[model samples]
Target: MIQRFIELGEGYGDIFEICELARTNADRLEQAFIMYANHNDKQVASLAISLKPVGDSKFMPIYLCREGIPYNAEKPSQRLAIFEEALAQLNVVPNRFEIKHSSIFSENNLYYQYLIGILRLNHYIPPMH
Candidate 1:
């Protein structure tokens, strides 16, 4: 199986888009997760939803709002709240994890690859077949 992060222009109006994707594809929704990273000394987060492959396809699309929302557990950002509210409607709660900031990687693609590896290792996503 092949999994890829389909970036949705960070945390902006795209947050709504991500939520829409998950809601519209609720049946295919595999997982919802938040990754927190420290970028430029500020804690930020990326919200993503994993969708199952369609019709025996090998591609699993992970819709992501890469490192945009400010991370705050004590008082979650409104953006995060919006995402949670959307998921709540679908009875889905997001799993959270801390990750190396994208800035550490030379390219976004490399960072995504690293995240995919981590997901596989944690069993959040399937391993290579």
Candidate 2:
């Protein structure tokens, strides 16, 4: 099976698109995620949704809004609120994970690969073939 992260840009206007993806593909929606990483000494989050492969297809798409939303336990984030609402509508709860920042890697793809490995080992996504 093939699994890939389909980035939608950092969570500015992309939050709505990510939510729409959940609503429209409700049947295939497998998981909702809030991945946290420290950037510029501030905590930021990446919102993502994992979907099952389409009928007979081997590709599973993980729609992601890369690290952008400011994250703070003391303060509520509007962007996170939007993601929560979408999750409520889909009856999906997000799995939160603290991770290494994307900047830690020389290439963006390597960052994604790191995330994929983490998810797989944690059983959040299927293991590689």
Candidate 3:
């Protein structure tokens, strides 16, 4: 199985697009997760939704709003609240994890690759097959 992260810009208006993707593909929704990273000394988060493999290609698309929103557990941001509300409607409870910031990598793609590896290592996503 192949899993890839489809970045839909930072967590601005793009967050709505991620939520829409989950709502539209409700049946294919595999997992919802929040990835928190410390970037530039600021705690930020990325909201992601993993979808089931498409057709027979085994390409699992995990849509995300990359690290742009502030991470505050004590007082969640409105955007995070919106995402949570959307997930609630779908009966999905997002799994949260703190990870190395994307700045560690030279390119965004590399950052995503690193995240995929971490997810696989933790069994959050399936291993290559």
Error of 1 at 76 (Å): 1.3
What lDDT does each candidate get?
A: 0.91, 0.91, 0.89
Q: Pairing residues by index, what is the TM-score of model 1? A: 0.95
lDDT of 2: 0.91
Residue by residue across 1-129, what tens digits does model 3's lDDT show? Answer: 988888788655798999999999999999999989987778998899999986788899999888888988898988888899999999999999999988889998888889898889888889999
Question: Residue 46 in candidate 3 has what lDDT?
Answer: 89
Higher-lDDT candidate among 1 and 3?
Answer: 1
The superposed Cα distance between candidate 3 and the true structure at residue 16, in angstroms, equals 1.0
Top model number, TM-score: 2
Alpha-carbon shift of residue 34 in model 3 (angstroms)? 0.5
lDDT of 1 by residue, 1-129 (tens): 999988897655899999999999999999999899998878999999999999979999999998888987899999999999999999998888999998889998999999999889998899878
**How many clashing residue pairs are found in candidate 1?**
0
TM-scores for every predicted model? 0.95, 0.96, 0.93
Q: How many residue pairs clash in each candidate?
A: 0, 0, 0
Mark the regions of model 2 whose C-alpha exceeds 4 Å error after superposition: none
- Candidate 3 regions with alpha-carbon error over 4 angstroms: none
Tell me the lDDT of model 1 at 110. 94
